[model samples]
Target: MATELEECFHYFGYGNHLSNIHLHNKNALKVGIGKLVGYELHFGDFPASSSAKNCWKGGLASIQEKPGSVVWGVIWKMNQTDLEKLDRQVMGYRAKDVTVEKVDGGLISCRVYQLSEYIPAAPSTKYKRLMVDGAVENSLPNDYISKLVAIEDNGQTGAVDATLVDSEETKKTVTNGDGVHTSKAIHQSEGYFLYFAYGSNINSKRFSVSCPTSQKVAVGCLKEFCLEFAIKEQTSGEKFVGATIESRLNASTWGVVWRVDLTELPKLDRQEHIKEKFYEPVDVSVDLENGESVICRTYRVLQPYSPFPPSVLYKSVIVIGAEEHALPAAYIETLRSLPEGPEHTVGPMKSYYLEATKN
Candidate 1:
């Protein structure tokens, strides 16, 4: 933590890092809202941590000056340690000191980055969604978010290969209680399969019944997908509330990514009612909070509970998971504010939740 007078600097993040949900996962301590005066946010080729050339290349974001324009974002207070983490996060950009007018009517001297080399290109659709989500989460001007949504994919190929990745930032060196070194496994490795859980699975206690050791590894966002609770169960014909992502190019779904053992695949399928056709597996890629990409599998709705509200009991399960993993505050509020129906069919599922939360 930086004190009031010890060289604490305000760092403005207008892109994906602007979301406190994303930043806190990266160890950023947001101080307040900031408006970068006399500058505009633009996309171009620079640096990246993901291997998706088309999705990440020639369209990353940086700030450019527009005489009368301003970009809005979160003001983060950083000490030396936090500064080092950010340096690793923005490798190919040149940092410059800029005075940002604080939203609270104060002037803050902060550091903002500019691309070292600007290559005109369009950003990925997913990338655009990230910026829009961040802007909304940070309470930036609504017009700026509209502008981000309007950026179409330039579709220009030949994104110059990033020269800075495979650097120190990409490595995770950890040793455990057994003196065995284990960095996280990649998506769908021999023994693990990454599962994206946006609903009841968000609640670890409930998910544990399926995969006992299942743990959410990272917070991720999927573009153009919205969560809907219309999926109905085949056997019960009751609203056994759950979330299935629907495609909506202008929307996004936030969730937790979990690494499950391959052996548990059968069990998870049973729990999700693959036999009953409630949900079917869908392979997709999601962007992690650490600026990296992971290929994961998520379930999509195959049935409908049609014209019914979610039971508060089932909704609370997801709320617990989001809280357990620290999702974006705004997204959580959205979950909490959703309209719910009666605890209509409180059978084994409700008892299971009661026992799960008890232990």
Candidate 2:
């Protein structure tokens, strides 16, 4: 049966003219049955003509050739019943005389039978689809980050219940603590901090609720890291290089930092989904408003199969009602104008912007 199919292909100059062709359906039956449905063959870069159609009338079933291209494939929707009838009426041969078996979804096994003698053609250089990188640049808005933190701090099941303070002073300041101005000295002396995030947590309404006292800043940084994408038991898919940049204060880089009671650190860890096995807290240096630098803690993914490639995302969040300094614009620009990454890329995660350190 295979010999017959090969002869037909040679006579029709299929192997030489067609590019990549494959069967669309994978779950096709294997055994040679008496009657079954035909195959659907996909050919890329087919010529727009009916030349192959006029050549073989009996064997040819249907052909779909795109216009203005030199690529084509055939589908022979023949069943065992038709084959048996053709053997008795058209060709003086019994069904047992011809070898017929199910090869694959797109091909059928056949014995020697030729309409015309022709030379086998060489393989064609045509492809089905081109490869593309799914990378994009996304800047995180400050309001969105605040909302995310609020959602995270609040419960995921319900909408956040944040109220605007009614004090005139609170309305004027970006960092008023929900209209509660008890101690003027405490409000004046409290320093602000920043933290940067570049991941699924970019949905800031949730993150803000998680850190209600923190404000979303419009600063970012560019950095490279490795991560994977999976749900529970799926294996590795594709490796990518991700980028991120920190927002700047005076001449230094600033990130989102939270100024909370020391006891809230544990809650922050949980809200950030910081499992010991998957992520670890690390201290890094960032720039402040007056050219000074400060050390801040951030979380990094430590899982084995993370698909986070080298790409960039915003990561800085601001703290309201705090006295921390900020980094300069030059510093932020330096981080943004980094060179184009190597081949593979990933990510456009959210970033934080915070006040600079006091030194």
Candidate 3:
């Protein structure tokens, strides 16, 4: 798009806009990674008049002029229409013309957005995840990625709120030609229940394999519950461990909460082997990062086995899922500290789980 011709403009994305997924969804063409000199990234408060405050309930990212500072971001080549769409999406930001330094030591003129007036604030976990994942996706400097990861959130989980939702959010259910509902958020509003996942299901890709109709709502913490790899499964006459949680004094288990519709309950139940009585759904109160608690349905082992280590592939899925969702680094380390089992499980999804960690 932004070739030698003048029909396109280079746009530098430093925040959640850095996500290629987001850019692609907006129909913007990603060019490459670049750096902006003398400008530093800042987490600024959403203006009171901006609708983003109601939707996000957290800080917003912006760039501020600062000497001797550099901000790394992805450069997207967008036409005039795409630029207009971007402007509408970023409500309070204003575009400014600037020059970006590409990796090949080439300078490119670009459009960068910034807030006219900045008020410092913390970002939400969801927003931080977007930026970190984008940085990793574009292979930005590891130190810069670490800096983005290290920034703290304001404790609001960026879960969709019914009353304060975006005006553009789908309000009606629309069925496609295949008879499948096109919008998952509409189901979330009408016939969905909260499901908490503390194991491998926390990874979006892994979770999608089993529960295609479900949508992640937020990250939650189940207090007084401790995670253990004690659910043993026999495959080819060998035992492999699976994850389960148990009540423990003063312990907390971090996990993801999903919004699942009643129609897909059968599918989820089948995956958990509900008919086989391997796991039973139990109701528990999961505390969200927004300081609110919600009742959620989660699975527990029906027959507890002796403590066993999980297979390397199994452990990799859980750890990768935890990291993929940008869960607390300390909790991820705890997952990483787990020892691998003697043998890997042979299952339909085994290859899928193993392939996920390579990225």
For lDDT, the strongest prediction is 3
Query: TM-score for every candidate vs. truth?
Result: 0.49, 0.26, 0.52
Candidate 3 least-lDDT 10 residues: 175-184
lDDT of 1 by residue, 31-124 (tens): 8888888898887874345332322544777888899988888887776556666665676778899998987789988888777775666776
Give lDDT per model, in order.
0.67, 0.29, 0.71
* Residue lDDT tens for model 3, 1-359: 56445677788989877773332234578889999999999988766665443345567889989999999999988777566666766667888999999999999999888976656889876567557757765778878877887898876542324344232323342322111112222235477767899988898888887778878788899876789877455434454456787654457899999988767765776777555545655556788989998878777664535777878888888888888778889999999998888555434457667666676
Instruction: Assess the local accuracy of residue 354 in candidate 2 as a C-alpha lDDT between 0 and 100.
Output: 23
lDDT of 2: 0.29
Q: Could you give candidate 2's per-residue lDDT for residues 205-238 as a string of tens digits?
A: 4355456665554333322222122211112443
lDDT of 3 at 126: 54
Each candidate: RMSD to true structure? 11.9, 25.8, 14.8
Top TM-score prediction, candidate number: 3
Q: How accurate is candidate 3 locally (lDDT)?
A: 0.71
TM-score of 3: 0.52
In model 1, the clashing pairs are 122-154
Error of model 3, residue 278, in angstroms: 19
